[model samples]
Target chain A: MPRETSRDNMLREKHGKEIDDIISRYPVRRSALLPLLYLAQREQGYVTEAAMKEIAQILKLTPPQVYETITFYTMLNLKPVGKFHIQVCKSLMCALVGSDQLVGWFHAKLGIKPGETTPDKLFTLSVVECLGACGTGPMMQINDDYYERLTEQKVDQILSDLKKTGACPLKSGPFMWPEARSAK
Target chain B: MPKHELILLKNMMTPGYTGSLKDYEKTGGYQALKKVVGKVQPADVTQLVMKSGLRGRGGAGFPTGVKWNFLPKDYKGPKYLCCNADESEPGTFKDRQLMERDPHQVLEGIAIAAYAIGAESSYIYIRGEFVLGAHILDKAVAEAQQAGYLGKNVLGSGANIQIYVHRGAGAYICGEETALLESLEGKRGLPRVKPPFPATSGLYGKPTVVNNVETLANLPHIVNRGPEWFAAIGSAPKSTGTRIFCVSGHVKNPGNYEVPMGITLRELIFEHAGGMRSDKKLKAIIPGGASAPFLTEQHLDVKLDFESVAQAGSMLGSGGVTVMEEGTSMVWAALRLMEFFFHESCGKCSPCREGSSWLTQTVRRILAKRGRMEDIETLKQLCQNIAGRTICAFGDAEVAPIMSTLQYWRHEYEELIREAEAHREKELPMAAARH
Candidate 1:
């Protein structure tokens, strides 16, 4: 509905066979919507109208159907987020262990609040539900990787490191949320 | 500390155990699948699991074998075994660990469960945020297929067990079985009304079995060792098997610990999890996930079994023990969990959608020192009205924190209210003149 900048069917054109493979896995074509949505999000940072329309066409659903699903899911952004989308876990487990402080540190460092992207479009901050990394309480997911057991200094280092290297070396455990010292 | 025969997390804790096909095979995995696939009858497999006294690790605590048997006996067309990897319950993280660290264990379990239920294909509906876990599972599924443990004619048993990992796009309600089925159909994750459970009609209108990751991961181990072996392991008869308690919050060692089910809350916290982070005395414990009711330090010796925890006014719902020290505020904790519920309430049912917001606001107001004594009564009525009125258990779950807190820590709520009353009284005369 916003300016339809992405006119091309980039989702279908680029991820045709891959999409086909995913669709084939399910008995119904519609079931591939989540996977295709993921692909669209991966191809671009956020899902575009053109992508949703294309997904609807591919899955044989109405645009509203696709739009409704997009709206329901928190991860599927309607607009483009910054290069690094930092989703801080604000659920009770993380809350108990200084996630609010982690959020404050992010605010001070980024000059932006939750649900806002930086002017430079480098980092986007959003408060999210538990990512199930409960043990390592004060955690955030920057794009795909998790940055856990955060402190003010660690948050500063992570941001600075991301700004410099396009990635944070402190990103942790896909499998294990290691002890703070061991993680470092 | 008492010993635990950690079947689920054993391989991951082993020295340099790569979770590859080779590593899983070396660790005596898939032996159960091979033993049971063609040799054992489907009903008999279910019987074996039933005998093992295995119950669902995901909140409900329903017997896994009984669940498998619910699939319409012989009318099966396209039955599904949906592994509920949507471990989004706040304070629960055992599923992510199982999938990421020991993918084959889960995959093997899925294969066995599918064969047991006569389901050819199974889908692991993993939480979308678990990107690494999903990727690991995808690779594991591929590896299992290549090794003939999955795909057409598994292990020459003529059992075509195929496992696929499906990712949910950040909806906690999708963790609910019927809601999960709806999402699997690429629709909004709204729950369907009961009468026709997933076992009767599920996943594209066929019979289905939705199971938890931790529950399914136990299948292979149960099959390898006899039913008697598993049944004898945990708290007798009812609650059987090792539970991976995700100890978080104000704990010295806040991590996953797989122990026998009968351990007391005190033993779990003090011995297994290394006690409170500081010298601050223990205040409260949400013995299960955020959905379960909160327990105070008085419930320290309450055993972590499903029935015992339920007897203590909380279910062993997902085994996510969240400890809070004396410094923490219970009302604030309730507010935090209420906020999560308010955010995640899929607006299918009016009671949940509207009640969650109201509950959250009331709790928030109390925590912020702006609440009245009447608001406490309002909160109680709201929780009561909402719990049993929804299509899903979410209604009951969302109210757990508020209801439990009000029950145990009534004094804290009163203290806040009294402060609000005093503050309001002081400001009243000045406000009256201004008005």
Candidate 2:
């Protein structure tokens, strides 16, 4: 068992109300584990060891249980990632639509392969399976946004725009929240 | 022959439709819920759905009403309704479109389902990657609740229904109903064994009904228009209603198209999707998502309904019609699909865990030009061993790509092996000369 640190106490204080709201959704506190993990990821870049311990403590489970759940999911990263985590869809539909070539193009331009963050920590390239934008294949998700119907030229433009303004110009459908777009 | 009417996607085609609750209500969205809540009994709602002949859209094609009727009438524990919005199938994106474009329609469907099943609380287990869709659903649910459509004696019917959106953390198996429930309970998405199906023992050991998003989305139309009207829309008696076919890969216009259930595959591909991209000769098609068996050009005229597609040696699994052209490599395609299944296997059972990994490595070896002639036989044996031996339908699904490809295109695999051997033979003398 890892000892509690001051950072854990700070996270608890910051997200205490949100954590309570998440726990209240389920009949069992243990069921709040995944949402709490997402909250922890939002606090930090990834699910750190201390955060897992804090989540386990909050849900009344052991650290090992939470760790097992984390390992099972591909999205819940155990280590730190870059600011813009670019996950290119490499499933059957996307691959057929040239996602493999898109990944290769990213590798050549970014000077980094899949699963590696750049020295500047601005980009992390990963080839993930099926983001459910099959019709608009060869898609990639940067942070919370999905950039679909991609070509090499589009990838070039997106990367340059992100490098310049910290945001990509292209916007595709099946958003995490289009309502937020209006709010912004 | 009357043209097939779009029920679920009617609002989607409306220009400048923002998928708002107001927009949905203007098109008569929650009128079914308003009518059914306080007036109609739960059993009557189930009967109406059964008579409408609506089946599950998330692969299995199980009758939705029959599934609802499975919950023991005598059980005293809290009944739950879980709307499965975790649409992660490789070629399937219909549910995502429905949720993102018309979320209130989906919620209205969920409310109706909750009323029919006597579930006071319902949850939509959306895919983790669908961040935008989740946010839209959150807003839609809140909007519906505020409008007296979802929470606290919904519409003054004395039926308190609360809907929550639960996001999954990027696991494909969570789309499986039992695994979905397990994940909703905040655990690893390993599918639970059957015989104790969700209707009896589910979600905190209570009676629960799990439904697909598209399946539930049809509830409003079925309730609004009578069951007879709904049934009359389909080309066939069994597969009654319009289905949104997601066409991708080598199609000129790759997108979701809503058509009657019994439309032909050729019509879906050429007529609706504007034919193949670049006028390339069509080689093969996976009529449903990655899980369905691969169909060749000979099966193009087959109907797109659940029963007809099954009769043609494939399933209308999620209606993800993935078209492949002549220049495309079948071996490479199968390898990529095998890679997906291998990565997604839940590892609860030995057969799927070992078999998917083994098949993936074998296909990779073949694609790398290192495969022997005997490897084809080994691949078939592995497929045989994996199917029907696992906890869920995943084992059978994982084998579909391999088995179907081998059945339809054995010569492609053989040709690759022959080319590899020829290349190796050419390299041997040069190696000896260098030495």
Candidate 3:
């Protein structure tokens, strides 16, 4: 946590134009901190010290200011994680409809629990707060896609598919309810 | 059942409407924006929204039109309107559906709001977890800009309205308006004190107006069909327009149901949501989102409006009706929701930061059969100290589950403690017998 191993700007060389454009969107330069942190994370799997320092320099704040913002958010990881990050919802709606069992299957198959990464670095599992997909309980968001209404079979299929091809074609929902009536 | 027409989500539930700009334009979207801009006085638009009696759909239920009027009339600098799309509350998915299915509806709504407030720019503060919804809104914004609906000189009305999509990095407290402003400023999402409430000074210290996703989405409708039309739909005198209730938990058909505001909770659960998921008797309901207190079976017949739900001693917050069946444990349920509050407390205030931890530990101990008889009293006391003691409503919201559950289901807590007591008695006697 010292400045002895300090690294330089990690994003400017690659994302100069994008970074300038993002900073210009706001009146205050500090307002671009969250977006830059996201870009840093996207470039690297997790937010590194160099990237944090780079963002601080761009936003014109001290390193601690950027570090504090990083710690406040749950999505910005401090360390590198697996290729497929599995975030299971553990809130009331999902819990009532057996999200616990979904956690259990992760234990048996991946041999990992929430907040853990598999030894092979292929998957990481976390039990997160509600993802606003309450109606579709027993849901997990892998990377960018949400895998909902999950069964053990579906979980198995998703895992095998991700392991083999790094992708799954299972139905991801933001599906609406009550069949949209024929436009009268 | 009488059919109440869908206002916000008319063709959204159907497959034909793609939510694209062209698709939205065809379905009479942005026509309201076209009709109003450069033509109607900004004051007149505000007047129409005031007359419609539309309230904030995001939990607090403040009047949408009245909130717009609070901005300083002649402030010369830059004012802003922020659309809150950070829908992370447990059991609430209504905003997510509205954004993904009808991006332009929300975009058009933002444009109308910006013109009314005389702001040249607006931002949609969406949550980080809504990857798909953000992508959809980003695409829709580009499409609207290309079609001359959102950029400078929108629809040739000489109205310069630009909308930006900003994403939050996973903080539940960011949903609070003050905290949301702070988060938007690239700072930690902490709630600021009131009295200089958001209307006067907000979002980098300007006259900022923050409206929820569903609340702003109603503007185009209010402009298109007269306020009298929307005013007559709901409970009428007060809570007007249809509310999209996100029905989850043990319901047979758990999804978003858009109905008029005055429907009975019984009609929503037993009829609209297709009853219970199983044959089990329904025991409890959280009439709003996670923040609302639990209402028992006796309260089912109460009208699902803001005033009536408040009269029934619970809020009609966020319209997230989470149903729980008979076999579900109230203590465990409260514990799950409590953990969510404790984890997302933001640690800015001591009472919420510290009190949530105590409440969660106490509730967990009671549920785990390690609770003392006095733990029930401890739980009640912690909840009392936490509510109304913070910078925002989160303190009050965090305590609702604990306080409300204890009120209606004290017997459940007592029963669990009784079991623990019996176990202790058996252990003490075994040691005595050994001696």
Query: Largest DockQ belongs to which candidate?
Result: 3
Per-residue lDDT for B1-435 in model 2, tens only? 115566777787666788998999899879999999989999999999999999999999999999999999977668999999999888988898899999999999999999999998899999998888999999999999999999998998899899999999999999999999899888899999997999999998789999999999999999999999988876658999989888999988788888888889899899887799986889899998999999999998999998889998889988899999998888899999998999999999999999999999888877777677999999999999999999999999999999999999999899888876777765665553332
DockQ of each: 0.58, 0.46, 0.63
- Which residue ranges in model 2 land beyond 4 Å of their true spot? A1-6, A174-184, B1-3, B423-435
Highest lDDT, which number? Answer: 3
A best-first ranking of the candidates according to their DockQ comes to 3, 1, 2
Clashes of 1: 0
Output the lDDT of residue A141, model 3: 92
Ranking by lDDT: 3, 1, 2
* Model 3 C-alpha lDDT per residue in residues B1-435, reported as the tens digit of each score: 227777888868556888888889888989989999999999889989999998999999999889999988878999999999999788888898899889999999999999999889899999998888888999999999999999899989899999999999999999999999999999999999886888899999899999999999999998999999999999988999999999999998888888999999999998888899898999999999999999999999999999999999899998999999998999999999999999999998999999999999889888887678899889888988989899899999999999999999999999998987877766665553332
Per-residue CA lDDT of model 2 for A1-184, tens digit only, reads 3333346555588989999998988888888998999988887778778899888988999989999999999988888899889999999899888898998998899988999999999999999999998888789899888998899989989999999998866967643211121110
Model 2 chain B weakest lDDT span, ten residues long: B426-435
Candidate 1 per-residue C-alpha lDDT over B11-129 given as tens digits, one digit per residue, 9 for 90 to 100: 88776887888998899988988899899998999999999999999989999999998888878488999999999889998898888888999998888899999998899999999
